[model samples]
Target: MVREILRVTNISCGCNKVMVTVEDGSNFIADAVIITMPLGILKANFIEFEPKLLDRKVTAISDLGVGNENKIALRFNNVSYPCLYGSRAFVYDLEKLSDEFAANFVML
Candidate 1:
């Protein structure tokens, strides 16, 4: 049976069984486990494993750089534009801005 896991901080697996430790220091066992987290979080090494990730995987994780992009959409009730059907949207490349401008801008 699969139990609802919450805030798992560590995972240990053997040939047949999987073990997980929650934030409250509670341990549980399972047949299989799936971890869902961002690449940055996985690279942070906050979660401990019985045996660490493979060396190539660790290197690949470390080699990745973080990047962010914004997407915008516009809607109209009755108005129609010239390129509405063909080219409906335009992508504003924020990467074109200076590093200083990007650093100062806030998403929210």
Candidate 2:
């Protein structure tokens, strides 16, 4: 059961169980755990992991560059496609259409 939203300070993936510690000195243990924290938090080392992430995983996370992204949810009362708002980016490219577009766009 999820309690209040508290600041997570540590995560330990042990052989028996996974432990998640919050700033309020509370620990949550479970048989399995899934963390969905942002890349910034992982890159900043905000929360300490007990054993440590693998070297390749650490390198991959460190290599990931974080950029500014703005998200806005719009509500259109009269629109037929209620949630079909187009998300656009002002990308300047020499080619009209290029495979580079695929590389730049990521769902998450």
Candidate 3:
């Protein structure tokens, strides 16, 4: 347990613990985990989340005032919890991710 974690692919907060998956398909679970990657890395979107982050959070991290290229928003009016559509905004499905990836996770 003395090696460095590289190529983190996904991080999920399940039940009362955190689960981290690496590019090598290794899984690590813990009470809590900390990520110290730089802002640039975050903007690059090299990693993915089980419950994908909302569009707003994604925009904030990826924006960097680079323009609309970073914003990715898909809309579905026929679906429930329709927040924004056809805009440069991102929204997550509550029923899909549950508390694991709440839309307002950043607020917490």
Candidate 4:
């Protein structure tokens, strides 16, 4: 059965068994426990294990981080670049653009 888990604690990993205490104070045992929490949550130390996790494991988790970059590509119809300019791409400073200039884009 798939259950909604609020928290996990008292994890004990032995030769062939894995036991954990759920938020409701119920004990659950399984062959393995798959923790799919996000890196951010894992870094927060939400779960408390019976035997504290190894320093190397904690170090690895702390060393992990995520980054993202957003990009936008624009294509203008009925537009041509001068051969002397030799480029079809134009970069704009959005903050520098006036509201009127930005409004023209919404019409497209």
Candidate 5:
């Protein structure tokens, strides 16, 4: 299998042209471009374009919220708890009950 890779840097936007500096320090231009990057990076102002983007697009981008989630995996050395049939043990807090809870052990 063959893999093709392109590395672009020093991106700049003009009235009708998109300029970029390649790995070899050569300049390249394009007419129209579509950028598909993480919303967080765009919000951080890491990449700058010559001409600002559309107001709607900017608003849409700013309105977006990105979050970080973590998944944990646990392995018990021994099964100390007893299980009967299909019964399961879960922890809950009555004072902090949330509407997002659809099931006993499920959280949204």
Candidate 6:
């Protein structure tokens, strides 16, 4: 059996209702809806809703930081450093590396 799927886009909200624009430029209305967009997009103020969110909720949202960091893997066919010196090595002030490199290395 085949199922029908509806794609709603361009959502706007007011105090008590939400308006959505569909692919065909048709409009839809709803009483309440849950938006599960990325926190980053929410933080960027890409969408707006009326009857503004509660003060505490707004504060929480503002305080939340989106992890914009990235990771890159540099795989090697063979180990460049000898293992005979022990398993651990020391590096000072590692934060000097680029943000992406620092985030990736911290995971190791």
TM-scores for every predicted model: 0.56, 0.59, 0.51, 0.53, 0.41, 0.41
Q: List the residue pairs that clash in candidate 5.
A: none
Candidate 2 lDDT at 70 equals: 100
Q: Which stretches of candidate 4 lie over 4 Å from their true place?
A: 66-108
- Tell me the lDDT of candidate 4: 0.69
Can you write out model 1's per-residue Cα lDDT over 1-108, one digit (the tens) per residue? Answer: 555647778999897998999889988888888778777777898788887778998899899987897899967786432232223232244445566655554232
lDDT of 3 by residue, 8-58 (tens): 888888699888888889988988887777676678877777678898999
Query: Which is superior by TM-score, 2 or 6?
Result: 2
Clash totals, every prediction: 0, 0, 1, 0, 0, 0
Q: State which candidate, 4 or 5, has the greater TM-score.
A: 4
TM-score winner, 4 or 6: 4
Residue clash pairs of candidate 3: 55-90
Candidate 1: Cα lDDT at 20: 91
Q: Is candidate 3 or candidate 6 better by lDDT?
A: 3
Candidate 2 residues 1-108, lDDT tens each? 665567789999878999999998889999887767789989999998889889998999999999999999878667432132235323333234355643544221
Per-residue lDDT for 1-108 in model 5, tens only?
Answer: 211344444578767787866556776678855556677878776665556667898889889899997999878897533332332323334224454442442431
Q: Which regions of candidate 1 deviate over 4 angstroms?
A: 1-5, 72-108
Which 10-residue span in candidate 3 carries the lowest summed lDDT? Answer: 87-96
Candidate 5 lDDT score relative to the true structure: 0.60
Winner by lDDT between candidate 4 and candidate 1 = 1
Cα RMSDs, all models:
10.6, 9.3, 16.9, 13.2, 10.2, 11.3
User: Clashing pairs in model 2?
Assistant: none
